[model samples]
Target: MKSITQLENKKVLVLGLAKSGEAAARLLAKLGAIVTVNDGKAFEENPSAQSLLEEGVKVVCGGHPLELLDENFELMVKNPGIRYDNPMVARALEKEIPVWTEVELAYLVSEAPIIGITGSNGKTTTTTMIADVLNHGGKSGVLSGNIGFPASEVAQSVTNQDTLVMELSSFQLMGIESFHPHIAVITNLMPTHIDYHGSFEEYVAAKWNIQNEMTSDDFIILNFNQDLAKELATQTNAQVVPFSTVEKVDGAYLENGGLYFKGELLMHADELGVPGSHNVENALATIAVAKLSGVSNQAIKETLSSFGGVKHRLQFVDTIDDVKFYNDSKSTNILATQKALSGFDNSKVILIAGGLDRGNEFDELIPDITGLKKMVILGESAPRVKRAADKAGVTYLDAKDVADATRIAFEQASAGDVVLLSPANASWDMYKNFEVRGDEFITTVERLKG
Candidate 1:
């Protein structure tokens, strides 16, 4: 990590105390900043804030007292999940105090160049692919950001010889200033997080922030298939390397049934270990990064050929009586579920869906439901999902939980059918996160085997 003296003696406010917030607070304190951490959780209940207090950082807990902003703080490193309209955040903005997410801190401290990956979907898979292929080619690639590990924590440990492969989210990007990555990848654009971002335009604007400080020397890998991505290419100073599954591009693309990078054939399109055209797009993006990093085509080929895909994302569980089960619990939005459904023969899919009702209808999913055999709906969005299913003329059932959904899907599945758990909404209404939701599905599937 680079030794940066910019924060020395600066009064910084860290709002919220998730892994990112805690890491940012600690890192700021280490840099001689007078750090103050505020969390909505009560002091006794917030272990991270308590620990920071023990280390001499000021702690304000129980609630976000608006008066905290009167402290004349120079910067506020907020938890990405915290809304910008949050009183403290809004007040800070009004007062002209810079607000940032921990990702900015990651950029400030890391000696290594970062490869930031962000999009509506496929960020995790693309980040994982680039990291894996880089590592396989003798390049040091550390995974961080929204993929689970805090970018602040990972950045501090990586040296100039390593590459930080970060999975950035629009929320985190919305808070960046000088957090520029040497290589940036936007997997694709879609309308999502409308609740948090307020609109698709705002969300897209936030994602665009990933390239705020990029220059001509940098590279931004874009999706040629997306009009928004193509438009973005013309706006960034970074050299645009396009990836597409539809037609040939100057960079990575598929042509004549083979994946090619800059006119050189890498592998057959069907040779990728993971299924789906979405995975193919992800692979094209990965190939662009790999080739840019000087990774051998053989290493890229080997990694892509064996990469089984990320957990909770179209993950193959096990087959029971010739009926296959897939755990795609990470599909928290309609577009994701659509992509997941596109990977299988819909006529043979017994889909288990429904979760948090994010104030959006499932009408968009009707087109994708044309051939599904059955849909097992659950959680808060069941009624809405059932409405869409009804409109699509697909058979539907309701389940109380993942266990019930899994059992019902299995029962409905005939030999050669797929029991897919790809909830098209957030799991906050029923589970802590998608991983937990996927885990429950896997556990129930295992029980079915027993």
Candidate 2:
């Protein structure tokens, strides 16, 4: 790790002690910062708070007392999930304190060059692929950020020879100050996290901030298909490398049924192990990162040809009696479900969808939902999803939960049909998370296999 002294002797507040916050608090304390840890959970129940207190860090728990802000902190490291409208955060901003997520801390200390990836969808898959490609080409790529790993923790161990492949969210990006990536990627933007960002424009602006500190020596890869991405290309100080699934671009693109980078055919689209045009877009972006990272074309092709889809992300479960079942529980938005539905023959799909009501209409799913063989809906958003199916003239059934939905979809499927669980809303309404929802679906499918 680089020995940085910017945070030394700084009085910092670590807000909302999730994994990211705890890591940041410890790191800050070690950096000679007078770190004060604050969390909403009670002191008795919070292990992170207990442990930090043992380490000589100040712990304030049970609630976010507004008076804690009176400590005159120089910086505040916030958890990405905490909204900016939060009283503590709002107060800090009002006081002119620099608010940041652990991402900024990771960037400050890491000896490794970072490659940040963010988008409404495909971030996990694209981030994973870039790491795999880089590793296969004899480079060390440490996967971190929102792909179920904390960059702050990972950065502590990364060497100068390593590359930090980070999967960033707009929430994380919103807190960043000087956290610039060597190669930044905006996979594609869709309307998401509107509740957290307050608007789509703000959400896009937050994602665009990944390149805010980038210089001309840095690279910013963009999706040419997105008009906003194209517009952003004209604004960034970094060199722009555009990728497209539809037409050829000067950067990575699809042409003549093959994936190419700067006109050199890297691999054919058919050779990719993962299904869906969405993955195709993901691969194109991965190609840009691989080529820029000095990875050989062979490594890129090998990784793409063998990479099965990410777990709970359009993952193929089981083919029971010739009926294929796909678990896509990670799809928590209309755009995600749209991409999932587009990967299959809509007429042969028994689509299981619905979850938390994010107050967004399912109108976007109309085109993909039009001809599904059967639609099984559940959770708080069931009625909303059903209304979309109804408008599409498709038959629908109501299920009690994910397992029940899985069974209903299977019962409605015919030989050669696909039973896909691509809920178009967040899993919070039904399950703890998408992974739990996906596991239940997979376990139920396994029972059917018996």
Residue 185, candidate 1: alpha-carbon lDDT: 96
What is candidate 1's lDDT per residue for 161-223, written digit by digit as tens? Answer: 999999998999999888989999999999987888888999899999988899999999999
lDDT of 2: 0.88
State which candidate has the highest lDDT.
1
For candidate 1, what is the TM-score? Answer: 0.72
Q: What TM-score against the true fold does each predicted structure earn?
A: 0.72, 0.72
In candidate 1, which residue pairs clash?
Answer: none
Residue 54's C-alpha lDDT in candidate 2? 96
Of candidate 1, the 10-residue stretch with the lowest lDDT total is: 339-348
**Local lDDT at 177 for model 2:** 81
